[model samples]
Target chain A: MPYIDIQNDLPGIRGLMAFSPHTAEPMGLLANALLHHSDGLLAAERELIAAHVSYLNDCFYCQHSHAEIACYYLDGDRQLVDQVRTGDDQAAISPKLKALLRVAAKVQQGGKAVQPADIELSRKEGATDKEIHDTVLIAAAFCMFNRYVDGLGATTPADLGSYPPRAKQVAENGYGPHIFSTSQPAGPSVKPL
Target chain B: MAHIDLPDLPGIRGLMAFSPETAGPLNELAEILLRDNANSLTRGERELIATYVSALNDCFFCSNVHGAMAGHYLQCDMEGIDRIKGDFASADIPAKLKSLLRIAGSVQKGGKYVTISQITDARTLGATDREIHDTVLIAAAFCMFNRYVDGLGTQAPPDRQYYINRASQRAAEGYLDFELYKYK
Candidate 1:
């Protein structure tokens, strides 16, 4: 039950579905980047950051899905997941990771919340400038993504395992191969909906 | 410069930091959960979703960092990152992913953005209820994270490698070992 009429007929918040920047093409691109891109942070760590940020925002969808995905990398450690979901950074991870998560948490709360002391501590733990920057970006990005989905009232499946296969495929194929509902191939020339 | 004032450096937004009992604990718990939880979605895919959401929000700081992180799990080309960030539908991703991204997008805007068709479509592509729920949560949470960072005008490091090494370390350590700062 969405509050507004979405041009796309979404399930969550109808208002955002019609107005949010989400579209088949861009969505695919974003997916590819998230799964296929090469960079400093590993996929698992990045997912951890996302889940953490989403939890802070209370974005149910983002937190749940990313958490599921994160499990794939953690050797299916549900206990570890519980620890993260419970806000215990001191569970069983490494000191550097703990430090990084700390900085990430600060970012999720507010950039200004990230203090010089935080940076000094992370650096002491061997966190580099790029790591700090990436963590902040990851936190900031999840915030927007959470708002977009919740705002539009997008439909979500009832089952949780529904995502792994798709995640696996996306992880394997990237974003360029998946298209939805368009009779024509995706391109700039394609008419805007 | 940020539109709001610093939370404590003598400004109106000075009261913005997360309280230990409030968003602080919640966010920390979330980080651990995603890192350790098991269901369906892969850690790489989840990170990718988060990164994409950040990019859509125009949160430059988040987009780059997460982008790099997602890259680490990608056993192949970084081109996937470009494709997803550019256009998901036209990109080379698999069907399940397309649906997941669609769900993630819905969350990014708001939960209401998703539609029955989207869920059905995801299921048709083999997405489960948990997958759908998690995707939505990720999107919703990122919204808060993005706003928190942009709202405060956090500074990002200029070096790319800085993110890489840190990412490598976090990837190996996992979130359970995350530490908290005890300011004196």
Candidate 2:
């Protein structure tokens, strides 16, 4: 049960997004621009980064959902996805991704937690400035997202199996239409400040 | 100097310029979150929420810039904003705002840190579901902004006057028109 009556049966951020279509519209766009689009990083690599951050934050829904998307792009490598999420050094991922994850972890700890050496390491491993920037943003965005979902005590499905289906759709279509343009009216009548 | 080769403009301004693709949607979010008149929150109240979260994150640039925006809309001085940033509970503001600030502070600590009592408290004080909803988003969004600004080793000038002067122009211009609000 969510802290507020969001008036939706959808789990996690979906319910929250449905509750606030206004914020959802841009947030969905941000997700599209950040994770779904082609960039210096592959969509799988980007989803992997997002999943890693979500795992660090302990956001079960976000981690699993994005991890499944990542798995879709990584030749369905669930084991590799798990390795990336756990920060296992022996994971088969490239050195550039490992370096980027280090930076992402630091951003998860705090903004200032990311140091000069972290950036240097990523660049040393062949991470571009754009890749580094997006990694930090993805990590930082997940922190907010984790807090939003948990802060509201948003509903989560009891079974992990429930996520992969939605994950498949998310992987196929990206985030915009999935989250935005809901038929539900936005929640709550606010008092003027 | 930043960790990357960002434009010479300081803080998020330069970072956004570096990636126009992400910048467009981000600025749109900012404009709607802070400046939307339909919100029950005054732009000043919403800015204060941003200031409080940025301050808790110890993000000097975000704290000061949004702090100034809060002051600009609320007609308070920098010191007044400082008091709110320092301890919003003790600041001379409405009971409703105090509760909202408390909620935002919990969000700064972590999402799960926000309690059921906090939600109930805000409700008892007359915050609507939308207000609570936006409050969480504002706090969450600032976490993203704060990290982006500092995660890249962006410069945060210590001079308070620069932010203070910029606040008026920024308040008039809002966040979307990135070209108008510039400082190095």
Candidate 3:
């Protein structure tokens, strides 16, 4: 059970967002700006960054759900999801993305943890100035988001399989509507028990 | 010196300038989180939470920036803010804020570090759900911000008054309009 009665059955950050639409609207916009709106980085690459940071933070709901979304963008490449989770640098990704991921990892540890060397590596791999800026911000944002979801003990769907369809919806429509979910799916019509 | 070729603007502002796209919504979020008075927690209290978390992360620019804002809203001087940063537990402030700060402190370490008892204790001390929710979110957001500022190795003005002098202007303007502050 979440520490606060979010008054909904939505899982993870979605539940928390529903509880506070004031924050939700802006937050959803931020997510869209970073992930959906094109600022040079591919949607899949950006989502991969979000998913990988969530994976580092050990937020199951975020990691799998975002991976599912990234998978959608990647034409169902589950292997990238696997490699990103394991922080496998050699995992068949563009060298630029791999370098950015390394920088993201440093941001995940702590802010000061990201050394000049990390930025150097990203630049050497041909990452743009904007990519480096977004990479750090994306990593930082996920750290905030991961804490928001977990600190309140938001619901994590027991069924990990449930994330893909929702990921599809998000990948297609973007994040705003989901955060302000008006249509709560009716409870399980067929009880598992 | 920032690792990236950001303009010489100080702190998070420079980073925001480098990426105006992300900065738009981020500034909106900051306004809602720190300045919106509809929630029970005062702007001062929320700003303090933001400040303390930045201090904990050792991000001098953010700590001082929001610390100045906290002082501006709360009407306490920098010495009081310094005391709160030193150890909020011992600060001369409300028990409710202390409780919330304890929860904020736990969050500064890691999300999992915030125990159930801390939440319950905060609730017991008259913290509404929104307050608890806001506190956690503020802490989380600052972690994001602290990383964004420090991760790029942005420089802070070594003089503390650089922030304090600007607090009045910033607190009046809220978070959305970086243009008004001429931070660009």
Winning model by DockQ: 3
Put down candidate 3 lDDT per residue, A37-69, tens digits, no spaces: 566899899999999999999887888878888
Model 3 residue A127 CA deviation in Å: 0.5
* Residue range with the least summed lDDT across 10 consecutive positions in model 1 chain B: B9-18
Model 1 has an lDDT value of: 0.57
- Candidate 3's interface RMSD, please? 0.8
Error of 3 at B69 (Å): 1.1
Give interface RMSD for all predictions: 11.6, 0.8, 0.8
What is model 3's native contact fraction? 0.88
**Alpha-carbon TM-score of each model against the true structure:** 0.46, 0.94, 0.95
Candidate scoring better on DockQ of 1 and 2: 2
List where candidate 2 sits over 4 angstroms from the true fold: A180-193, B180-184
Ranking by TM-score: 3, 2, 1
Model 2 agreement with the true structure over B125-155: per-residue lDDT tens digits: 9999889988988998999999989998898
Candidate DockQ values, in order, are 0.16, 0.82, 0.87
Residue B108 error for model 1, in Å? 1.9
Q: How big is the positional error of residue A111 in model 1, measured in Å on the Cα after superposition?
A: 10
Cα error, candidate 1, residue B123 (Å)? 0.9
Chain B TM-score, candidate 2?
A: 0.96
lDDT of each: 0.57, 0.86, 0.87
DockQ comparison, 1 vs 3, better candidate: 3
TM-score winner between 1 and 3, please give it.
3
